[model samples]
Target: MKRIFTGGTILTMAENKQVEAVYVEDNVIKAVGTLAECREAAGSGYQTVDLNGRCMMPGFVDTHTHPMMLGMCRIWADLDYPKVAGIDDLIRVLKEHGKTLPAGEAIRGYAFDQRNFKERRHPTAADLDQVSTDVYVQIMHASGHCNVVNTKLLRAIGVTDETPDPPGGALGRDKDGKPNGQLFDSANDLLSGLDGVQPQNHGPNIHMPDSPDHLMQRFEVGQDFFVRAGITTVNEVQLTKQELNTYLRARDQGKLKMRMEMSFLSNYLDDVIALGFNSTFGDNWLTIGSIKFYSDASLLSGTANVSTGYLDSDRHEGYNYHEPEEMIEILVKAHKNRLHTLTHATGDGAVDPIIDAIEKAQAEDPWPEAIHRVEHAGLVTEEQAIRMGKLGMIPSTQPEFLYLYGDGVVDAIGEEKGREFMPMARFKKYCSLYTISSDAPVTTPNPMEAISTAVTRRTNEGTVLCPEQAITVEDGLKAYTIYAARTLRRSHIAGSIEVGKLADFAILSESPLDLKEDEIQRMRDIKVMETWLDGEKIYEKK
Candidate 1:
């Protein structure tokens, strides 16, 4: 069947190209030109879609996400700001949520940042005990790099006061050296018990398992969050065995509606190698993309390895996830095996070793075309950006972090260094390739919000972090579209609207390009009216 769409701004997102109409045949774009050309391309038995002055562009490609986690978080207690103001509010919210759950069922709360709390402290085991002394209670930090569990859960997990912190992770402790329920990075693995997804220190161990059936349902719920946000393609950046099984199950059961590229955790490198799996290892709908590594801990959690040291007195110099030699060896092995690597390096100190390892990997076993990525690159320096650009590394950034955690970031790193957070303008100048993503469940998957934040550099509190580091709205759109597709190595098929490309488009209420200076700040006001994937309507705003 052939379909023609016209009467609106069709942003091809190809060098800022605009056309009058688009002609689609089944799942592929047949022509993108004037209406007459589209009409000619689509002969008889063609349906016309009147855009009615709305805007049509490529559906967003969020290159970094945790769909399963995002979905699971939907069912958990939301501890995002304005909803839960302080530690007291957090405890109350969790308690209220616990009452609604079946008896003895674990209570989990997500997106809580102690930095935003009126008390300015993490809710300790005792604090969460206020929520539940009987049932297991765990509240994850907004960074997803840590979690604070109640005393009951900590005891259940067998983490005692004498338990030594994991090599790449730490446990928050009280003055007398008692466990305080704050689990950072690999310490979160304790919450997984023995059977859950354990990435060891290779990645943050936060993906606790639920029943397969429930997880499948949660996966659907999570994909909907992206679909409704006009995101048609996502790269699941941390794929453990549990996530792998869940994704496969979702695919086999026909529950997957959006395109996914899974990046296996470095912990699974041996397994992947044994199975002879390399990048782009699966079909279009569910493909294996890269090997994910964590060079450092979470920026928001004040654990990100920064040479300058955090402003926080307790954390001071942040920590690295691996020794430099260990990280290099892993990178080299992956590189030799012809796999793309995406290392989470949120701070300058964390980023340096990653770049060094990449350079070493290429020098020893060259794969010049390999698009190894530096995930976050949140506190990347100008020199580091240039170095990454020289090595053809992709800086996968989340501009929405500025919107969601900008003030907190400033508080942690101080204004001077925090101003360089996500530096889109610097990326443009130094790096040939960079992409914007939501890091959903941490923030939102809303591209418009990210774009707005990228352009305005404004925080949720209305303070602009670094106005000079802001990119134009057009560039922001490209970051989510073409550049993101390139990051996923799916550019040929996914990014823009062109002949022979997949007909994945987002119909918006207005063109983001049309927004003026004052209107740009309100860019998120432009809604995603409808989302089409594989030439079929998948989501529509009611």
Candidate 2:
């Protein structure tokens, strides 16, 4: 049966087109034009849905996220800035959560940004010990580049004073040189590789796995979380083999609803090459994505390879996860195989080398369509932006970072250098190939909030970080809708509403363009009326 959806303002988001009605058949859009045209297109026996003057547009495509991590966050303790005040508050929350779990089970918490705490320091093992000495405890930083473990967790993971830090990573040390239970970068693998936990070589947030029977429950919760926020597609930025298999298992069981694109860790390059799998390898529900290579840790964690030293410490020039030559070698191999790649380059120092490596790979292999990208592209300078534009480099950025942590960024690097933090407007001037994302588990997946931040350049405290870098609301929306699909190489099938395209859309309570510019942040208050995927309404506001 066909369906004719009318009585709403439909923004096709394709070539800046608008229509009054849309006709959908099966799972694809049949036609989009005026009400009479749509009704004419849809013959008898067709269903009709009156939107009652609502606003409808393409569903959001969050170019970077981790569903498994989001699921883990749902099960774990919430340490987001709003929930905890200081170290004592953190301990109190953990203590209360620990009591509800089975004895000896590890208690995992996530999104704990020390910058938000009154102490202004990461909670040490001693701090976590205040929560529990009998049960193991692990708390991950909001950046997803670091983790903190209690004494019991350290012992459970077999890290001791004698344990040497992993290469290019660090285990926090006490004044007496004893391990202090904070893990950074690759050191996170110590916990991720533990029994019953998901494994990762590139990022943080390790937690116990869900039973096969229970996986769907947690997964549905995560899906609802995304759909409620108006996200229709997600790029699983970094996933280990086990996590990937879990998603595959869910798909086989017919549990997948949202479109999920995947990228493997760089360490898995060997497997990817052996399997002859490049990006975009599967059906719509699940598919291969870029190969993620972390050039450095996140900026807020103070481990990014920044050329300028941190303002707080003259000696703190951030470190890279791989040597220049090593990273280039990996890029060469992947590019030679014609695989798309997204390097996590957050600092000026990190950005240049990764770009150089990609340029070199393209020079040797000559695959212009691969669409190589830089994740974060956090501190790209003017010259680098021009070079990136010439090379057709796509920047997958998280604008919400500026809104949530802009103040800290200004503090890390002085205000002068800080202005370079995610210069979106500059990137648009130099290169038009950029997409915005939530990078959820680091921040909430709210497209409205992201768009608001991008357009206003204002932090949560209403401090304008760099108003010169602001973009228009329309540009911000395209970054999450059309351009985002372009980044994932799926623009043909998804991204917008057009003839023969997938009928995936979000119905809103009001039109964003109709609101005042000052009301951008309040766009978060706009209710999501319904979320439709493949012509089926998956979510509706009660």
Top candidate when judged by lDDT against the true structure? 1
Q: Candidate 1 — which residues are off by over 4 angstroms?
A: none
Model 2: which residue pairs collide? none
**Model 1 C-alpha lDDT per residue in residues 72-160, reported as the tens digit of each score:** 88889999998998988998899899888999899998999878888877789999988888888998888899999989999989988
Each prediction's Cα lDDT score? 0.89, 0.81
Per-model TM-score versus the true fold: 0.98, 0.96
lDDT score of residue 137 within candidate 1? 91
Clashes of 1: 0
Error in Å for residue 134 of model 1? 1.3
Q: What lDDT score goes with residue 362 in model 1?
A: 92
Candidate 1 at residue 329, lDDT? 88
> Candidate 2 has what TM-score?
0.96
Per-residue CA lDDT of candidate 2, range 366-443, in tens? Answer: 986887889998888889999999898888999889888888888888888886578999778877678999887678
TM-score of 1: 0.98
> What are the clash counts of all predictions, listed in order?
0, 0
